[model samples]
Target: MTEEEKKTADTGQQEEAKKPETSAEGTKEQKEEKASADTKPETEKKADGKEEAAAADASAKDDKKASFFKKNDKKEKELQDKIDALNDQLRRQMAEFDNYRKRTDREKEQMFSNGEANVIEKILPVVDNFERGFDTVQDEDKDDAFVKGMQKIYSQLQKELTDLGVKPIDCVGKPFDPSFHNAVQQVEDDTKESGTVAVELQKGYMYHDKVIRHSMVAVVS
Candidate 1:
């Protein structure tokens, strides 16, 4: 009803409208802050996931590299083993070949020696006939030029045989040996010991230290 009372009522009404606007502004700021906080947790979770994925990828790559190296090492070892085995086999084959060569050489030498001995044995009979024919010649024939020439030839042949590692074995007046002498007759002799060779009917010959012929002898018993 009064002017003062009417002015107070208008001021009170203006204050009531300002209070509601302030409260609305504070509620909007609170909502904006809550939204910001929620977005921060999502962004941090995404970053952590990326880091975990990168670390897993790096570990997988490292594992693959290790596996590759291991496989290469195994293959190298196998190849080395094969090389060693081949080397051992080659050595064994070479040794076998060497032994075979040595054996062949020995056999060839033995065969040559045997052949030489056999030829010498066959020629010895001709020498014996020459000596026998000379013994049958008359004493007058010894002065003949033809007889002397025959004696020279026989002496030359004997010298050639001596130079060829051939020698005559002496059996008479020595003890009889079955290995060197073949007894053709037995005689009773008081001068020589028993089982002694009294006479040599055929001369024995040796070639290169091996007997080519045994002596035919008469034994004294």
Candidate 2:
């Protein structure tokens, strides 16, 4: 063929070879870009998962701490309530014991007073007999040894009775009281007022504030 035609054909063949190489390079670059894009998405997903795990762990720890505090607070409240109840019970017991002690002391005092009154009441007749015996003694026997001894013993008995809180109730020339004197006889007297005690027939005795024996008296009206 001609020289110019041969040169043109050679140039056309070189251009065609260059076009295939260019197309292959473009495909390889596209594949590498797509791979890079995929790796970026995976890395982002891993980072998100790690963050989520860290958040969950922190939440669990906070919940555990809150529950522990709540339990401790409840226990403390229960202990305080128990202590208060025990204190109340102790106070009640102490008050009950004090009341029992006071009651016992009062009962003992009442028993002692009653016993003394009963003994004094029984001995009243003996005391009356002693006074009558003293009245029966003659003037000549007043200086006798036996009479003097009897008089001293009677005086000593009276002094002992006075020391024991025993005293005679006054009935003569006093206003008649049913609580202190019993009227066995009534008399009309112009000198004394009505409902007045003129004479005492039997002696009445008092032990402290209580009457052991009532006075038998004659009332003048």
Candidate 3:
């Protein structure tokens, strides 16, 4: 062979070997790019999952807080209702006690007034006998020592009865009242008006403003 032709063939053979190495390097770069793409997607998915879990936990905590507040409010309402019921019961009991006290006081006062009236009614007969004994005395015996002593004793008794709120009812020269006077007989009298008391047959007595004994009288008609 010629030297120029051999040199040209050798240069062509070397260029063919360099073409295989270049192809291998291009294949390696394509594999590395594919692996980087797959890893990037997995990393983003993990970060998103962690963020979602955090949000769900925060929502659960908020729900628990709201439930706790609701329970507390219900318990407070129940306690307030119980307090109001107790206060109403206490007021009712106090009112009942006050009414009972007033009733007992009225009963005691009525009983005491009835007892006093009964005693005054029994003593009125003795006062009438004393006045009759004094009326039977004569004018000649009026200056006797025994009669004077009896007069003094009768005057003292009358003073004591007056001090105890006892007084004689006036029946003569006054209009006849059915409330204070009882007529035994009707009489015709020229000096007195009709339907009036002409004479007091028996004395009547009063205790304070109440008539203990009615006046026995003769009416002028």
List the global CA lDDT of all models: 0.93, 0.93, 0.89
Give a tens-digit lDDT track for model 2, residues 24-118.
99999999999999899999999999999999999999999999999999999999999999999999999999999999999999999899889
Q: TM-score: which is higher, 1 or 2?
A: 2
TM per candidate:
0.67, 0.70, 0.64
Ranking under TM-score, best-scoring first? 2, 1, 3
TM-score of the candidate numbered 1?
0.67
Distance (Å) between predicted and true CA of 94, model 3? 2.7
Each model's RMSD to truth, in Å?
Answer: 5.4, 5.7, 5.8
| Among all candidates shown, the one with the greatest TM-score | 2
lDDT of 3 by residue, 1-221 (tens): 89999999999999999998989998888889999998999999999999899999999999999999999999999999999999999999999999999998998976876677678778777777877887999999999998899888888888987987889999997889999999998999999899989999998888888888899999998
User: Which residue pairs clash within candidate 2?
Assistant: none
Residue-level error in angstroms, candidate 1, position 94 = 2.3
Q: Give candidate 1's whole-model lDDT.
A: 0.93
Clashing residue pairs, backbone N/CA/C < 3 A, model 3: none
Off by over 4 Å in 1: 1-62, 138-140
lDDT of 1 by residue, 41-86 (tens): 9999999999999999999999999999999999999999999999
